[model samples]
Target chain A: MSKPFLSIENMTQTFPDGQGGTLTVFEDATFGIDKGEFVCILGHSGCGKSTIMNILAGLAEPTSGVVKMDGFEVSGPSLDRGVVFQNYSLLPWLSTLKNVTFGVKARYPDWSKAKVEAHAREYLAMVGLEGDVVHRKPSQLSGGMRQRVSIARAFANHPKLLLLDEPFGALDALTRGTIQDELLKIWGGTEQTVFMITHDIDEAILLADRILLMTNGPFARVAESVEITIPRPRNRTDIVEHPNYYAIRNHLVQFLGQRSKELAGQQSGGEPQSPTRVVIDKTGPAPDPEPTTKPQLRAVND
Target chain B: MLDNLSTNQRAAVLSVVMLVVGLLIWEAAIPAQKAASELTEYERLTGGGAPKAGVPPPSQVLAKAWEQLSNPFYDAGPNDKGIGIQIGYSIYRVLTGYILAALIAIPLGFLIGMSQVAYKAFNPFIQVLRPISPLAWMPLALFIIQDSEASAIFVIFICSIWPMLINTAFGVAGVRQDWVNVARTHELNGIKTAFMVILPAAAPTIITGMRISIGIAWLVIVAAEMLVGGTGIGYYVWNEWNNLDLTSVIFSILMIGVVGMLLDSAFGFLQRAVTYAE
Candidate 1:
């Protein structure tokens, strides 16, 4: 198999618990995201999902292991890794347009001011914020609108990878749906590699090509990487009806509900194993039901 | 009667009414003139002929205010300048000192806020020095600088520096981590992040510090000028008091209040400008 475009190998993060003992947030977590692939990480709180995203973004260093993007070891924050924080971390003092322009200009300093502004506006328009709304400050905009600006800013930089830390966690259901669709539309146009962290299973199914489920922490590991086979241009309304949807959904729900807790109790001996990969197919015939252990499906013809 | 008005308007009307009533009572309480025939032999011997030596009536103070204001900037002589010139001197000193304090305090504040080591090292010194009165510096400043004008300016500087320094440090330290993370993700360097992200984020708090500083500076300038005995509103009040010109003293007091309010409101406007709802 070809080398993954973004690889996180055995990353462990620990903090001093102030009692002279080290508190391990997560340990020996391993995952890889391919180029132009959209991957979402699913975990309950305290599973170190944000810590993993922060490591990928280069905002924080893992206590051990490395994050590699485009074959280079990530060290610190760079424009090549764009981030969309859940709080819609737009510079509050800048107008929406200026905020986007600020990043665009930083990315392409040689570009003319007009060119930078035009590029920013284009991204803003892609996120459905156009005309006068772009001139308003984040304070003047609604919460959904602010998040849209943040997405626009991240996309406008044209980073090699986008790290979204629960980007829609704060939005209501309706707003989340709209922004998710907008994000997918934008992602479809660019084929951007994305690593997103979220607790929402439906959102993961809606946006990601693959979902990485993380077990509960202290020594948490990425327990499984569920490959989503839902076809492209997928609609939220129609996705659940796909034949593979229920199989994939049930597997994810079962993993999160019971398997996560069960795996957390099972102490692996040495270095943790890579997450098991599961593939779901809508048109393929079902394999014989194995009453012993979970059946691993055969690789499909792409 | 105040029911139809907004709260501020009602308060303003009440203030005016209270002022008028207070003035009438004051005018009535002090006899307009001493009864010349009822003067005691001791009063006659003591030459008590100084217009009864009472607080000047409101009408007299109002007349003096109009006269001084009509030619505020007139500079007949150092001691005989118009009220405007006196106030101008005081404001210039306050601004010069306040600006110098800002130049030193803001960058230093950023350093202190950004570094725990610096904060720990400097906090005790700041705590000890901040509470000492600005005028308390006047004697040493005069001894070293040996210039009354500079001493007055130095006093204003001492008075205004603490608030701005503390507030700026607090504001810079309090910038949201997420915003800083955004700056880092954009690959902004430290300088750009400071100017573009941290500065704007901390501006409102810094302005609040500035507001407090200006109010204190204004207050201290009056006292400083009084101590130095130079040409300022504060000095003018002292000089008028020495001359027993109660009307002029009252007029200068009103001017000081008005100017102080203007200085405060200017900072208030700036604070609002930088303030973000979030």
Candidate 2:
């Protein structure tokens, strides 16, 4: 990929045991994210998605290898990398305007007070908050409103890279859909690179330019990189009409299901697992997505 | 809001009636002789006769209060200085001591809260000093400062510092790690992050501590003044007892109660003003 904007190479993380040995969480893990790419890392529980994110954020150190951003070694947290936490980490004492302004003032210290405030207000409005509502504290706002403010604060800085650790995992399905739309709209408006961790297959399929599927446990690695060719301005309601959408979704489902089966087989060496893979036209007529066809698993004879 | 208040008002009115009835029963239960004893004591002062035994009236004390309250700034006699003058002197002492205490205590508390090493070093000293009564400080204060007014102020200072200090420390310590992360992610450096994030986040708890400090300050002031024998409502009550002016003594007691209530209310209002919920 001509040296992606961000590159992680041979990253291995090990936690030291009190007894002289080390527990390896991931080994030789590697990935690269290009500029303006929306990448979702998906895995089952305990796959070290958060661990990898923390490593990239410089909150935690990896045991081996390096993470480079724009061809510079990642050291500590930087203004170049903005993070939106899943918990909506809005400081309660500050009003929405002040909260967003806090980020702007820090990143752009040379900017005058009026300029900082105007920038904050513009971002708040971009996230759909009106002027009257901007004055209210986080406690006074609803859950969704708080998350919106969080997004505004993160995006306001226009950081070179944005990391979201399951930002919408805590919301309800309906709220999740609404927020997903908002997120897409906001992403469409910006050129920042995004890497998000998600458990929802649909979310990964809908939001990402590429979905990085991870294997289950201790030696977790990106098993597959699925490129989504779904057209631009893709609305979720109409996304199903894209022919490859069903095939790609089915492929991912089949991949995850088989990965689970392979692990189970490794433990017992029972059946010959054959995970069925769907190959369909990337540019062809779309059919109504069906739920009846359960993705069949095929064996990869390791 | 009006519609929401009807039931609340009904409950409040019911409680008021209950309180009034309880007071009436208390008044009725007092024996005639005891009532007369109370009035006789009241009568001994102000050169006013005791009320009828059955009903110990408030008019006579009210008149004495009015006499003291009117021209509240113009000293008419040695014992007849305006109530406002006395109250002003007391409030002045309290403000001087309390503000001084807050100024020192809050920042110190924040520092202690922020650093484990500082907290470990200073916490023992705070624990030891906090329990020593403000009244106990009175004797040391008198011996050192030598002036009753200064001693009284010093005692108030000692009494008020601990709550604010502890609260400030706790508030600062309890600020969320997530907020700190946000500040760091935004590239806010140490001092700026502390000011913009930590201080504001900890303010509610710190203010609550101040409220408690104020109430304690008011309570300690009366005792401090009484021990120091100064020109405050506390001293006024003690002086009347010396003069066997029981009515004046009771009046001073009422005045102390009212002033204490006002101080509490003032702090309560401040707490509300500063609070912003998450």
Best by DockQ: 1
Estimated TM-score per prediction? 0.94, 0.83
Task: Kindly provide the TM-score of model 2 when superposed on the true structure, using C-alpha atoms.
Answer: 0.83
How much lDDT does candidate 1 score? 0.89
lDDT of 2 by residue, A1-302 (tens): 28889998777777876799976666776678999999998888776789988887777789887899989899888888889888999988888998899889888999999999999998888778986999999999888888889999999999999999898888888888888898899899887799999989899889998888777766666655667768788899898998778877887787677764354212112222222222244675555254354332222222
In terms of lDDT, the poorest run of 10 residues in model 1 chain B is B45-54
Candidate 1 has which clashing residue pairs, if any? none
Docking class for candidate 1: high
What C-alpha RMSD separates each model from the true structure? 3.5, 7.0
Best by TM-score: 1
As a TM-score, model 1 comes out at: 0.94
Instruction: Please give, for residues A175-278, the per-residue lDDT of candidate 1 as tens digits.
Output: 99999999999999999999999889999999999999888877788888888889899899999899888788888888888778778734444585488877
Q: Deviation in angstroms for A16 in model 1?
A: 2.6
Q: lDDT (CA) for every model shown? A: 0.89, 0.80
